[model samples]
Target chain A: MSMGSEKKAKRVRIAPFITILFFLIMGIVGIMTGEVRRVLEQAVQVCLSCIGIG
Target chain B: MEIVRKWIQTIMALLVNGSWSFPFTRTIYQGPLKVVCSPGLNCYSCPASTTYCPIGSLQQLMAGIRIAIENGQNFFGLYVVGTMGVLGGVFGRLICGWACPFGLIQELLHKIPSRKFSIPQKLNYIKYGFLLFFVFLLPLTVVDKFGYGELWFCKYVCPAGTLEAGLPMLMLQPALGQTIGLVFFNKLAILVGFILWSILASRPFCRTTCPLGAFYALFKKLKLVKLRHIEENCTRCEACHSVCPMGVKFNESPENAECISCLKCMDKACKFDAITLEIAGLPMGSRAGARIHRPKQGEVSM
Candidate 1:
């Protein structure tokens, strides 16, 4: 297999895991502290703003 | 679909303005337990907010003159900014795009029938200058010996304050009207001007004024959500740029800091299905190259 193919396959799997892991970590922290929860929410808002959803 | 999306955006803003509570809400909702972020950047001290605004909260964080919370140990002014930064850094600019109730008001104003005026290219840079000169430098450097933090925008201007804070407070507590100073009237005039301008333009605030938008724009390259360009299929027509209000050259960099990701231009202009949102479908993945732009050097020094 070529190096490019190996990298693509690895990235595809890792990307989804990374995305999910981020939300999971945020959720756990959000539940623990009011500040963390608010920060996570603000993060979501910032994401939408960059995209013009806010 | 564009109209539909805009309407959906409108409703969401109303809900946030009315219900979503954040730190700023904590300032006004002292009577009963409530949390609500305003639809716009209104001052928490204005006495009219049904909800607290994030920027308003930053100002409120410094409401009293006693800066040393633990007897000169903790710096609240810096902390106020930290609150916004942590929020801005994590979510990027999504708050401005969808959740901000004031943004909703701007969107609705855009629907009003009027001749739209495009801002001159030269004046477009004003937001950045305002960011550096007014927002950070002046506020940080010029301090009142009494220790009350100076909020230039909130105190003398900011229409969001009038609509969300000023008007509401005055109406709710008519007694305040008797003691109103010239500052209230001056700020009201600026707010009214912004309102009138909003009717003729599409989110005048977002386009050239919002400091928060400026911050999130700095993070567009590495934001969690991505707007990808399928280069192989792109016709180089540059339709995206022509339609984009921000004048973003989407073909060169779809995720340019200026890009609000409204996706309207993409939805309307992309006849070739060249721009899309997804995670690793072969056609989409093959287009934008493998390298995601790493977060640049001090792109956001804030």
Candidate 2:
């Protein structure tokens, strides 16, 4: 591969780290804002729609 | 490697749906683990499930976003989005190939001795529509008198929900049969259709319908772990195409959005070192180094 292509490949490889870091920050904010608890409340109940009963 | 992948998939399916007590109790698991989201498309309503389905949880959040905003509650669903994002970034559609219970079921169903068919490539784009409409747009836009939206995907489309939760729940508690209506029958029809299609085609739902798989496909080009196609080493032999469950032609586009990273191309089909498993652009191992012995013809490599 050419040097330019190699550089592009490096950038592509780095993209996942950046994406993961951004989402991880958002996840921490969600947890701090009590999103986990909300999700838990929703999940604990048998979702009627999920069981095709709604 | 195929055997190893199958074992991992089976173990993952069992581990996520680990509430074995459901058979005797006839009730869904409400353990603390339900708070965690499984990476695959297993249903939270499944009696034996220990974790939530991200797509279902996402729909729940989307459907209630209006009410949440009016009530001054957080409605971003950042945690679920982040969870999905992190998993997708790390593995991409490898979860579909190796972890998803529904994907495993489809693969096993396809294994039943029968004539197989290929899905139209254009249909692959339909999943993005399902992700946009059923998972997000419909739920967020359409609301009831109370300003609460419905779980559109789970209620109308998800065969996983029907197979894992609906059928079992109805069988376990026959009293719930009174509640069955057109919607239940509709979902059952979709489930039956997909089951039959799975036998006829490989992973038809994952290829054409799954919103979660669509979400993961967004990260295919940038996922940390990926199959790197070595163009110079390739001989234009279309062996990889024949073995791909997701129908990815690796040489033409190494980063095809449809690829599930199942490693069938790398581990089973490639005679040349055209494909290599990579982590962050670094080649972890070659295909030859990974396989001890190759399966013979008609031996069920998948």
Candidate 3:
């Protein structure tokens, strides 16, 4: 593959990088602001009820 | 007969409970005498399960509202998935092959009578996308009214969760049934879909849905535990391909991250033992080292 093609592949892989960055930010905000943590808790409870599995 | 022995052992371990159950059964079996039992996905959350499952634990942690406390310390119970991943990067998804309850479930599902099928090749990569979006990103980003993260796949798509925890919980604690809603039906649909797909294929969960498998796949090439192919001896006969349930082209890379390290092709085929587990440190290639193992006479693949 040409250098340009290789660069394109690397660029495509950028999605993963963005994804990882997003999660890291969320995790930090969750741990620091506690807002994210609270959201996570409510989500889990809602899911439990939704699935009807307790 | 060997399969029967494995079944007996698994049942006994489950009934006995305690540490004798599950994965410990796996560890003991791997102690020297290898004994594999149970051919389906059976996470520790299953009423039948005796050991704690990492996937189930991860889901529970993500979904858990209240964590129990013991001995003056708060314990998230089974929130060991993150630890598993940290350590997995060390030995990797060997757990998928040996210890994972769900992986076992999929294997057993292959035994059901049906016309096996493999999804379109290019479409298979959709799993990595699932891993990223459903397993990781969504869970991390999508919060609830309260603030804790959501285990997106477990809450939304995991059949293992539905079967292992949902069905059994509802059956054992029928009161739980009254709470059922549209989400219940949605998960039920997903559970049924995967079960139907498994009957037609081998491990639909492992191939396209398992986040744990996805995590391990990332470390597959780097981990010393790998399927090695002595390429110099390879004849390119593609014997391993026919035997592989995951539909991986083994010879393309001896150790592809997609592999569960089930060793089915190597044990049954590979007349020359050309494809074998090599402990020596070898960097993973872009893909994997393709291995073509010839199955022995009278050996039937799932």
Candidate 4:
């Protein structure tokens, strides 16, 4: 393969791995920070009530 | 297959927002299922919604973190973000094409007999701006009198919220009429505009301004299930491009972020079996009698 094409292939291969890794790190941080529980607390309620309609 | 997918989307829509009496009760579903994240742009405020809206949860996370920072506390929400990332990595925008109730509504609207118009391809980038500004920046930065940041996208721009949650709330509880203000009317106007626009164009919201759709688009290249182009068999047929609702030139960029994995470009459009759905690198279905080979010039003459 040409150098340019090989470089493109390498980038494509590496992108997903990097993204997955970043997500894994963030997920761990979120759990450690108690963010997951916070989200759960917020999720377990119903407040919109057509008040803001948002 | 498309029909089957449509049915699944409809079923999911019904299943996720299945609380019928919540409208009269004026209470959102507080079931255990609420802890889960909806894979699409569903409004958590909707009485029937069984799960949290990922975009709304993300904005809440940012707002909470900002509040926490102000209070000298370290706080962040991982569940919503993690769920979104995992879902995006696995399915990409397949939710937009196949599972989103709002996307389904737009598709139905586009089917109305009207003079359809194609948007400029460049407009697709606008969703990224919406994602950066409305979903992230504004929600995290803009503060209320109590130093609380509002969910700007949900409060100001989300037509899905207005349609699913707002309308139903008002209809179910006439008492909310007294509290209806200018902001509600403005949102109503926006919803009407989207409804009208959806009729004239295909998936206009998904193409131009859905922050959640934009988020999923980022993971398009990384998703496990994807459309693969069989370059060897391709006859340069532009059928895939023509059928693509998102106007993706699948022949050139099969993994285009705009692609929703609707598979319309597969069985029907690509006559030479050029495009097929694959998990990892392996094709996922029967190949027998599926291909439509276009005859060569010599064969056509003969």
Candidate 5:
């Protein structure tokens, strides 16, 4: 492969870890900010919209 | 390998929907597990689902965004997005291939031994529209007198929700049947339509309509676990295309967005070992790699 193509391959290989890291940090922040509680509150109840009753 | 995949699909389905006490209690599971999101499109309102459906929770958050802002609270659904992102970054559509109960249902429906058909390639773009409009734009923009938006996708579309939650809940609490109106019928019609389409075409919803699948497809090129095609080993036999349930031509484009990394091509079809499963640039295994010790003919008398 040429230098440019090799560099592009390296970026492709590294992109997932970067994406994973960013999301993992966001997820941890969300948990600390009570987003889990929000999801729980909504999910625990029978969502009328989901059942098409809304 | 196919049997193993089927077993995994069955086990994951049961594991996520593990709240088996619903029949006796006549209610959905309301446990702490609901805080976590399942990787697939299983409905949180499903009687036995112990985990939240990411798409449903996302729409709920988007719908409540204005209310949250008015109350001086920031609610971007970071947790839900992050969870989905992490899964997508790691597995891409592998979850759809191996873990999603809805995807499994479609596969089973397609196996009913009828005339199978291929989905139009143009239709694949529709899921992106669903993701953008129903999941994000509508839920965030269209509001009622209370400044609260509606869960447009869940209320109007989402055949998985109808099949997993609506039909079962109605069956369980027949009294709730009276509340059913045009919206319910509309959703039921969509569910029925998708069901018949799934029978005729492999994973029609996944290919053409699932918002979750669209979200994950964004990570196809970046996912850690994926199928890689070695061009040097390929004989251009076109066998992979024939076996792909999602109709992905792996040898030609291993990183195709429609690929679910189910490994059907790698495990069953590729004769020259052109395809291999990779995790973080390392080869996990390949079909030819596994057949190196096969017993020769007439040499199996142990």
Candidate 6:
């Protein structure tokens, strides 16, 4: 097998597992800490016009 | 499809920031929808911006977490980080191709008649530095006496902030011009420099300095949506590599972070249909058929 194909197969095998693991950890932490509410509050308010538009 | 995606993304950007009647509105959109993160790097400070820029929100969360830690309060920026990870995991840099207004702007600038140039592959890592220092580190560590961390990336580097918010804000309210100091001009200069660079090299900023792009790029390997290469069918023709605007050698690394999933190197460039789009490993777009033409014996496929 060529180098590209070999690498592609290896990555495909590992990637999905890593992605799922990351999301699982993050979800647990966010729920436990109430960080979701904090993020929502920050998202709602526009800050001082630093970039000039808002 | 890329063009259609671009138009849809541009309209989404405009519509999301659709509070035009309040052009001089200093207050941000404080609606229920604001809790959702925008996929693109649209500036939250823009008068019309209803949802928050993920990068900005990430920085805010980082800074806040740092301050909370200092104050001995329990705080962690899990939500912003989690949302970003989910988006990045699902789409990778496809967001750059289909959603970002700034990415659209860079592409439009690149389309102007000019001599095109390519950046060194090594330079791609600079965006990570911006994410680490400007967006996260500096904002968390570099606090004033009042214990307030400045939004370094938004203030100093993000051209999207300047174009979407700063310039328009200045134009709308001339009285605020006096407050425009070294920081504003410095950002404006960076924005102008990026504009020139984009005209010369497609997505110069996206490739070299966009922290948001860097953040999403980390998930390129695990992304649900991806570009796939079928080794059996490839003629080793470099058409895909040659046509790639980001200069990714996709034949070798179909899921490289630098690939924005523009699909230019797929059906258009590959006559043999060697390359394809894939969602969760399911094949998409046109399928591979017979080789366009057999290569003569001993001719190099690479």
Choose the strongest candidate by DockQ: 2
Worst 10 residues of 4 chain B by lDDT: B293-302
Each candidate's interface RMSD (Å, one decimal) is 11.2, 2.0, 12.2, 3.8, 2.4, 3.6
Report the alpha-carbon TM-score of model 4 versus the true structure: 0.88
List model 5 lDDT by residue over B235-257, tens digit each.
67788999998989887888899
- For candidate 2, the per-residue lDDT at B247 reads 82
Instruction: Write model 6 residue lDDT over B68-177, tens digit each, in one string.
Output: 76776555666667777888888889888878888889989999999988999999999999999998889888877767777788877889889887876676667778
Candidate 2 chain B lDDT trough over 10 residues, lowest sum: B293-302
Task: List model 3 lDDT by residue over B167-262, tens digit each.
Answer: 865666567677787777889998888878888887777877777677677766555455667554456677788877778788886667677666
Clashes of each: 30, 0, 36, 1, 0, 6
RMSD of each candidate relative to the true structure: 10.1, 4.5, 11.0, 3.9, 5.0, 3.6
Q: List, in the given order, the native-contact fraction of each candidate.
A: 0.01, 0.70, 0.09, 0.36, 0.71, 0.43
Query: Model 5 shows how many backbone clashes?
Result: 0
For model 3, the TM-score of its B chain against the native B chain is 0.72
Cα lDDT of model 4 by residue, B85-196, tens digit? 8778778898898889999999999999999888788999999998998878887788777767778788778889899888887777767778877778888888999999
Error of 6 at A16 (Å): 2.9
Rank the models by DockQ, top first: 2, 5, 6, 4, 3, 1
- Provide the lowest-lDDT 10-residue window in model 5 chain A: A4-13
When 2 and 6 are scored with lDDT, the better candidate is 2
- Candidates 3 and 5 compared by DockQ, better number: 5
Between candidates 4 and 6, the one scoring higher on DockQ is 6
Model 4 CA lDDT for position B185: 84
DockQ, candidate 3, vs. native dimer:
0.07
